[model samples]
Target chain A: MYDARIMPKPAPKKHLSAKEGESAGGRVTVSIHDVASAARVSIATVSRVINNPHLVSARTAARVQEVIRKTGYAPNPFAQGLITRSSRVLGIALPDIHGEFYSELLRGADAEARSLGYHLLVSSEPRREDRGPANGSLAFGLIDGIAVMITDAASNLLKEAKGSLLPTVVLDTDLHAKGVDSLVVDNAGGTREGVNHLLASVPASSLYFVGGPEENFDAQQRASAFRAAVAASGWKPRADQVSFGDYTSEWGERWAEEHLKATGKGVFGVLAGNDEIAIGVMQAASQAGVRIPDQLRLVGFDDTRLATLIRPRLSTVRVPMAEVGAASIRLLVRRIEDREAEITCVHLPTSLVVRESSVPRA
Target chain B: MYDARIMPKPAPKKHLSAKEGESAGGRVTVSIHDVASAARVSIATVSRVINNPHLVSARTAARVQEVIRKTGYAPNPFAQGLITRSSRVLGIALPDIHGEFYSELLRGADAEARSLGYHLLVSSEPRREDRGPANGSLAFGLIDGIAVMITDAASNLLKEAKGSLLPTVVLDTDLHAKGVDSLVVDNAGGTREGVNHLLASVPASSLYFVGGPEENFDAQQRASAFRAAVAASGWKPRADQVSFGDYTSEWGERWAEEHLKATGKGVFGVLAGNDEIAIGVMQAASQAGVRIPDQLRLVGFDDTRLATLIRPRLSTVRVPMAEVGAASIRLLVRRIEDREAEITCVHLPTSLVVRESSVPRA
Candidate 1:
């Protein structure tokens, strides 16, 4: 079974005469002409053999194959890169490997990469805590592409990278780098939908929106939607409705406690940045003798694994992780395959997942 | 900010320096000396700079470095098969990219390579359906070294590979190939401890193990521990106590349902191979009206994030994913620095985390 499957292998790249603009990096760094010279074969013969070979005599093909294999010839990667300069690998550097969002993104990227037979090289924050741009040193390698999660893809690192690396696809982050792709979710739209769903069904008089990282794109986008949702509902609550933090569960719990302790508190609904913050909100609410949904129509963003696992099952706006992963890979690989392929940007869809966390607030 | 962290950087070659021994292929194809001369550097300079660089001056180092860089030089990768050759990129092939385990490992390996100014070349499964060894076609000119997962190391693609082709390290899958430094999690001990934990916590009357891939070493070891745990507790539910799968949550849920259907029975506790399987089991149990801990106890291996994310938080044996990741990088890099240092097999400790999942069966 395995042998049969191995027979029809992916054909090696043909060093065709089809011309490509020399990447400002000189052409012929390691050319097919060199392999042809050492093997003493016509360039056409080599190209013909590489692309389609039943036409060649067995003897001629074997000799060429020997030389090519012996030289460890740079054909596929080099030829592909020359044509599109897209690195087949999508480079994503994150701050920590322990997060659910990162893991989900990896899964999404994996599914997409596997469909295309590409891979991702993951590098976390450097071991030496002193290292600046922990993954900047890693960026020098050949990659057809890259995908950066905005939270992990801090602006500092993006602002200071070597010129002419892989074409990047940014996920949920602002990008200033020219010639790169950016894909952000409809953070505002999704959050607004979630809030409207809760307010339409719930009888809560006042609502609050928990926020995430101060300068975070998703956090800011979600907060804007929350403000709009509250305004549309014609409910006038205090300015203290927004509580910001790093989107940690700790922040969720702490904010809940602080709200409960504050004078004349009316916090009823919380629209959190992501699921982690939602978890903290739930835990804190539970301990503070506040019931979920009944007492607070809570909603979270990025419906990760934590959503279902939590009690009262967190209602959230599914940020479409798999979509981002698939889109990023496709955009990056296309960039690698066709240089003139205009830099592509995609806004993947998100939806509200109504579960037990937010229901008709009675 | 980026100039600083230049500090870090595996193999399969039983006869790397045996000048008199016949290579498995009976050919000494290329030598480092030839590469040095072609690049215009002295033999000692190439040796110090290439093999061990404790003795080279900075100015000569720059010139020699430029020459080697220009020549696109590398040491022989097919150690015993073809004598003299070089490819600078270190190739890593991964089974999947989505899991916490694999991502953390990639992070570890990337960290090590980046420190030593080495670039990484990565590929997903060349064939999506075929899980066999990688065809030699992907092995061409891209990498100077290789660190493989070794899941299919027993296959010909692995057996036929030249040990000297690159510096190679096998991760977790445990192929003790000659001249290859391997990093494996001590599955036997980790499983034994997990099984022992189950025995201590659950009732003696009922116990079962839901295992991973039958061919997997990690699964087999864990299964064996189940047998030992049962014997110590003087309980043998049945020889059919074991259920097989690919360590996925889907399979775990399926197996749990099937087991519940058959024999019209319920076990006191379920000891599973991984967090994925445990999740499956939990999902199945909840659907079947089986209350966790109160009605049944459960424990799983690999204290993955999913364990905590799930309700009645999984009481699992922590596999120390971060430690495994950090340690593997250090071990591989240290091996590169000094090969004679024992072919180390590291076993980062596993701890049992008792949560609501495995409360003393009420």
Candidate 2:
């Protein structure tokens, strides 16, 4: 069904009739038909060339591209999407996008999506009711698929996304909902390594698990992992040893300060939920005259940039954040391309990096 | 014209004809028409209620929304965008989005766009020649307007965005091209304050300005500001005293290492283009038995999170990156709403935050 035509070149920037290219705003909106007509190719061929160039012959794609450049023909994605039923856009919903972790993750996701001929419509903030239903339905209508990084297991976005029946890949959350792919970091394994390292020197009774918000999925996983690690090491799990707060340095500092005041003086091992908390603990412990690796051995999760920047560099679990992000996109793309594909759950491994913060029991 | 009709409530999950709601994939795709028909309103009225609810009566909007919820209608954004000639999406192109500066900027931009009922299609990586014209034309076809953060003065993204005839806002670059709004940080004023702070403590001959890439707009401005500050202080500017390199801690460390190796021993003041460079200088100088504030006073630009986390907090100029991002989106949205709006340039102020890195002469 190729309708190839050899047409003479049209004058550059010439005003076209209302139906051909002129928009309501009187701008010369060069349509895809013009590009196809000038390139001597069918409209379907032009569409395939723009979207799936590999499906079209190299010579055909090259010729079409030349015409597109010469005519400055920009195919309206809306019109193309309307006909194909594929927006060629992916929605990325993250809890927040301010930190190095999130930024690196976005960078990886964006790079992967672009390579696959998809654009990312990123939403950083949580959905607010005041913005109306348009905000909630926006992704469902516009994007082919979604990749949601769920910090909280009880996220409304997750619930809504599931209810929409769209192909989705959930990150960091362990709740394996039906018909959704999941990619999570090995929180338990990583935590066990950290706890085992700390326990080699400090007593189990002195070890404390300082975690993020109780409702957070990652935090819960890390906390549970700590308890399991302690129990595996033949130590009874104590509720008093674990404290739940925000994933912030301030919270870590406050908890450490309170613990230091209550205990008066002694060596202790602390496993912080994340690096920020570890940094906070380090700052507070330093102020309390507790020298790291001497009086207060510590290990943090998510070996972020801060792990190295902090004095007595933090020894922690290194989560492949960017890789996690990329893998999620890969999984989502597979599901989108083949809706009948088997649902898969990927658990990316996390490794422990030793630094000045946690030296052996010399 | 308003079209409203009172009809019997339709059965939920009932099969719709191919033209109405069913797709070729045999999946139930609820169209805006079905919702409009079930809600007893015209398709245009339903569109108005979803996109511009303020224009529709509240009672009618509520009733339409209730029908949408009941019928599980997700309006195809493609169809709506085709009719309105507005994607309700803004494209953001940044040189890199992995750092605190960029992430914070994106956060502000995303939040602002969401508030105005627009989504952000973000691209972080530079355009590659191998990616084909499809990658370049993607933004023009998909987004209503664009906000580009040009790290280099000669960015292809800038050139292409300018030529796309789409409403555009440029950030961090001072090209000030026709028909494009520009938003930039006050690099000159900020650098002047930093240089002046160092001048008060050290002789002009001992002061050195370590800048980023020579071709970068911000770097060029900062270097110019440094030269002016030195001249205004009645000191002859020496070309050897200033250096241009990549904006990295490694570059800063290497530069300082070579400088120290050549000039055996002397107290000097260094003004780094960014905090990473300053941090590198600190690490190298410390290793070489040189002390901050006492032996080699330093000041950095872009007071990032690392500025505070680094020991002896970095003394630097704080760029309002998030505000810049938010401002750019606001400007882009205004232009998108009124394409004939006058091109504007905004220069946001940056302030000096003196910490422990630089202390005045006794």
Candidate 3:
């Protein structure tokens, strides 16, 4: 299990032979060729015995094992992978790998993958456009399947992943493609609850919707839900009352700063697309001397850790990010194991968590 | 580039042959064997031409590539990796991956790894002991090298990683072994600055240190620095003033709640092990009607995002977590590229970010 000589120094450039048993120092090492000859079997047979022993005959496997033990022949993992055609690795492609939301999702995905005897090969690149055909080949070559979290509806990543013809699971997006499984948070339902919670405290006309990126599917669902909920309450939101921007605190702060300067004195309700945006609004409102739940009431989406840590403890829609991550892996694995399995589009439910930011203390 | 037929369904169970060119439906596909025969070159030469093109003669590589294009034969990545003995993947093993600190560190590491043409294979398991020899082999079989972040000084992860004899870089720990490079934050220097800042406002005896897990190297360093700084102020702190617990807000809250109950009404200073712990202390003190800075001034380490989100904006020590992560990969890559490179330990500096939590606003 603990062989020090498993990986010898890489052979010199001049030595172009495919054999890995030869050390750079001109030392003779036990090769798979030697094992196959000793066992009176082909090299492929020896590899199958090492990587997929169940596939080989018991008598032949025993003979190969005996020869391997006697010869001190350590099988190269790459060779084993080549014969098995299974790397036991899952590729994960996300919009970004930073922040609490992504962290929790990754944590869940990682745990599920590990439990299922698979390791995660996370794409470190953040930009979607940068991951071209080369990256698709890289993913196809390395992993059995891939789990892609598509934040932007317009992203070509989902199409590219589908094009790779590898089993795939799409996360946090509403768009559906053939031969792909999807796991999405109930964004509209959660947004409706958040809007109603805010409407209960403040007038619907004073309500504002701060959305995520325009191309984001979750953001679109949430924004649409906010409009529908407001309409049901018999109030139509003005065009100026709704805004869309990237899901960052900076964007939220900028929008709030401008809104506060324009509407200097009014009690209003805000439904931010996500927690980070809500936190930004809270910061801007605080700086402007607008007391929370007094001059401004806010509800955030994705009950991140920051929701509880903030002063007026933000009210938020709790998206089960970790559960979604785990579910994505399960779905992807199912698809990989049985390519003919029915395509699934799962929607995990979300609930609203009411806190001091939405309702003033009695 | 978007070849739909790249991966056919797996062959039937009874088809024990190592060849991947035959589909389960009995369709004949172009294989590497065909490409090699067509080009009149050895299979190994064809593989080298595809994977390590520089190692093959320009004329031979062109011939093989042309044959591959004409035959529409896509080289199996596993076969390519087997020939070159390079996966172009880096493994990352962290104690935990579900927090802001770890997220930021991963983001940095991921970015750096991508820039270096390597993807990260992050170990999903959280516990150290669960990663036995089997896990070690899995890692050794998959990645070219690894970056391990050791939180607990007592953790055998470092030892096991060393035993694997793979090129490794240890992060955020003081413990060092031969042949393994290390990258650590300047915990002591940052702690000293935090302590002196608090001492200028409050008496040294009234100061308390709420540390992370006793086994954690960073926690140990911060605690020692606190003691040294207090002693430098010509004051001896009671043993009761210092405490060690896990780096969570619950521990900070629990410790502060108990301390408040025991020593009820005077102003004091606290130096928490990390931002999470500091936020916990703040929450408990707030619930108990203790005002930050005015009643209980505090400082924390690892200026995480929570530091600013919490009320009064926590004064904290800023560990360059992202830079530390990037540096670890750089060191590991250096070691992986040059086996005989000098094993060096790098300490990135930390600084104090003073905020409203530590000083009363004028």
Identify the candidate with maximal DockQ: 2
lDDT by residue for model 1 over A59-108, one digit each (tens)? 88898888777755555444444344344555665555335666566667
Residue-level lDDT for B206 in candidate 3? 90
Candidate 3 structure quality by residue, lDDT tens digits, B253-312: 999999978765777899999998999999899999899989899999999888877668
Runs off by more than 4 Å, candidate 3:
A1-75, A128-138, A175-177, A260-267, B1-75, B128-138, B260-267
Query: Quick one: best TM-score, which candidate?
Result: 2
**Residue A358 in candidate 1, Cα distance off native in Å:** 2.2
Candidate 3 CAPRI grade: acceptable
Better of 1 and 3 by DockQ: 3
TM-scores for every candidate against the unseen true structure: 0.72, 0.86, 0.83
| lDDT over C-alpha atoms for residue B252 of model 2 | 90
Q: In model 3, which residue pairs have backbone atoms overlapping below 3 Å?
A: none
Give native contacts recovered, as a fraction, per prediction: 0.22, 0.80, 0.75
Candidate 1 displacement at residue B198 in angstroms: 3.2
What's the CA error at residue B205 for candidate 3, in Å? 2.3
Which run of 10 residues does model 2 chain A get worst, by summed lDDT?
A: A10-19
Q: Which segments of model 2 are wrong by more than 4 Å?
A: A1-27, A36-69, A127-138, A261-267, A360-362, B1-27, B39-66, B127-134, B260-267, B360-362
